[model samples]
Target: MVFEYAPAPESRSAVDIAPSYGLFVDGEFTEAAGGRTFTTVSPSTEEVLSEVALGGAEDVDRAVRAAGRAFEKWSALPGRERAKYLFRIARILQERSRELAVLETLDNGKPIRETRDVDLPQVAAHFFYYAGWADKLEHAGFGPDPRPLGVAGQVIPWNFPLLMLAWKVAPALAAGNTVVLKPAETTPLSALFFADVCRRAGLPRGVVNIVTGAGETGAELVAHPGVAKVAFTGSTGVGRSIARSVAGTDKKLTLELGGKGANIVFDDAPVDQAVEGIVNGIFFNQGHVCCAGSRLLVQESVHDEVLDALRRRMELLRVGDPLDKNTDIGAVNSAEQLERIRSLADAGEAEGAQRWAPACELPERGYWFAPTLFTGVTQAHRIAREEVFGPVLSVLTFRTPDEAVAKANNTPYGLSAGVWTEKGSRILWMADRLRAGVVWANTFNKFDPTSPFGGYKESGFGREGGRHGLEAYLDV
Candidate 1:
């Protein structure tokens, strides 16, 4: 006899999505300067979610100027006072988290469980954590005095819309910098909703402006003469462009870019625990995470055992509605992203790697890809070197710890890596030599507000969390 668990989806009525939205500048929602617009669709069912204003160069300039005007007064405000506003935003975020989580799932095509449990909670904690530093900046060890870097131009990607916004906005505000932020075109709703949360918290005008558009708008913001600081989180190619645009300017730039993380397992690793880590590393958020462990390096002695356990575990992962509480995998962010993942996976197969995915039926509508693994993947394989940014893992075998390090460090990205082992000495030995910014001993994809997170080389520069993150917005 077979038993099936009934589908349990979150109530959509908990959140209300507007038919249309405009650019949020100077604390007011208004039409774009050129009156252009774009449509955002729910990837789950190919349904139109909202029509939003398409911000152009003129609109970007206006938003940047507004931020510039607000910066003087905002920066002059007492640190203790700024802390109050940050604290209020944190409280309001916690109160409205459920609503925001549902909306994020709809717009971003991620499970509500992740938005609720991981993204939303961390977003609030970021604000609260930075708020505590507002009045204590002098002791943060930067110097006796540090000043805000005027208007900050921030660009965030769609994978974790609201959370990315919080990462950039909360700290900028805490450091007394006004901002003109642009959310990705596909997932702008949650950031727009965040604009309301700021208003409800009574944040000052232009203190946190959000503009919605594609690459053009972001370019204009990054190149704007009025912006003194720029923070971006997205692809590496775009980050390079922004770096060049701000080269001769006085803007302080920080970028958190792409990553191809490696999860290494030793022969002595606990089979059950390593298998779970392997799943969480590559499959979390459909593998959209920048520091996701997309490459799996297993000891040759235990390669077959790990793969067998991983395959059994993949079969148990439920992939379907983003709102379903039981769904482990959700729709890819968009047609373009899905295509990118597909193309990369195809390259893996064509390059002589063995592809394997569990026999599972995906939903009829929406963009979806099953959790997959490529065996016989070598260091030269595209799947091993490139950041697929999907629920895909490429497995490679290594005989020694030195060989594992060599394979892991071969990529241009140095964002993150994980090691699963019982011996404490081996974990430390691995951690010290790994080039990644954050190394996890027994876990992957775990984050905390108090920890500093960033990468080396092409994976981007400057950290986003902890006390170190605040320095990006300050003038030491």
Candidate 2:
């Protein structure tokens, strides 16, 4: 008999959703000048969450002007004083973490466990980590006196909305730059909620502004003359466009873009542990991660062994509502994303790859895709080469360590990779050879505030965490 879990849903009452949200500029929530609005929905239930004001070029200009105006006072404040404000923000985030997590799960459709444990904690930790750096930037190895860029224009993706906000805003503020930030169109509620946190922390008016809209609004912010710096975390296509838009200009720019990360398993790897790592690497956040290990490379000698174990593990994953604490995989963030995953998976089958997914029931009301994998994939297949950005894995096999390294670094992206082996020396050897920004020896999806995370080559440039993250915002 198959065992089933009892329904356990996290209470949505933890958060009070507003009927409508406005663009946050000059420390106030104001309606867009164009009077445009868009509805945000709960992807888990297809219920309308709220209507958010759609920012236009005018709104972007207003936000950039506000950030520029606030830069003078904000940059002149003592580092210790600036640190105090960040500390308050961190404490407030901790105090209200449950509320933020519930709201994030509702908006982003990530599992409640991830929104609560991974996203919310990282958001608060990022603030706390950067808070300490604010008072110590002078001694931070960037010379005796690192200066702040006047104003930073930032754009973050929808995958990890609030955590990405923390990644951008925390370091920018710690470096003493004011900011005009744009959260992704699909997930703007947490950013709106964070504006409330800033108000509660008594943050200076205009120090941070959120202008909400789609690509056009983000383009305006990136191209705005008042912005002294630009930080973007999104698709490589968009990142390349921003790089060109800021070309021949004085704007300091940084981008954290997409990846088709490789998770390689060797014959000597701990089979059980490697299976778990493989699952987490690709399936975490419904695989809506920029650095997700979407490609699995196994040693040909142990290919069958690892594949069998992986199939067994995939069968055990519970896929369903984001609010259910027991859910292992949740709904795709939107209908558009579901369609993308479907198209890519279909291509895998048409290209003569073997596709596999466990028997799992899906809710009818929301965007859902079963956890899927494709074997017999070649390097030239679209599924193997492209970034699906969903819960789909492409499996390949190699005969030797050198072949594995060659296959891993064959992609245009170099965001992250994983090597599963018991030999410490082999792990170091593989790590040194991989071109990725981050490499996990045995584990996967591990993150910390102190570690620097970013990509190389076409994956985009500049780091987003640790002391290195500060350099992007400073006038070093």
Off by over 4 Å in 2: none
lDDT of each: 0.93, 0.95
Residue-wise C-alpha lDDT for candidate 2, range 239-351, written one tens digit per residue = 99999999999999999999999999999999999999999999999999988999999999899999999999999999998899999999899999999999999999999
Question: What tens digits encode model 1's per-residue C-alpha lDDT throughout 51-119?
Answer: 999999999988988888889899999999999999999999999999999999999999988998999
Count backbone clashes in candidate 1: 0
Q: Distance from true position, residue 22, model 2, in Å?
A: 0.6
Q: Using lDDT as the measure, which candidate wins?
A: 2
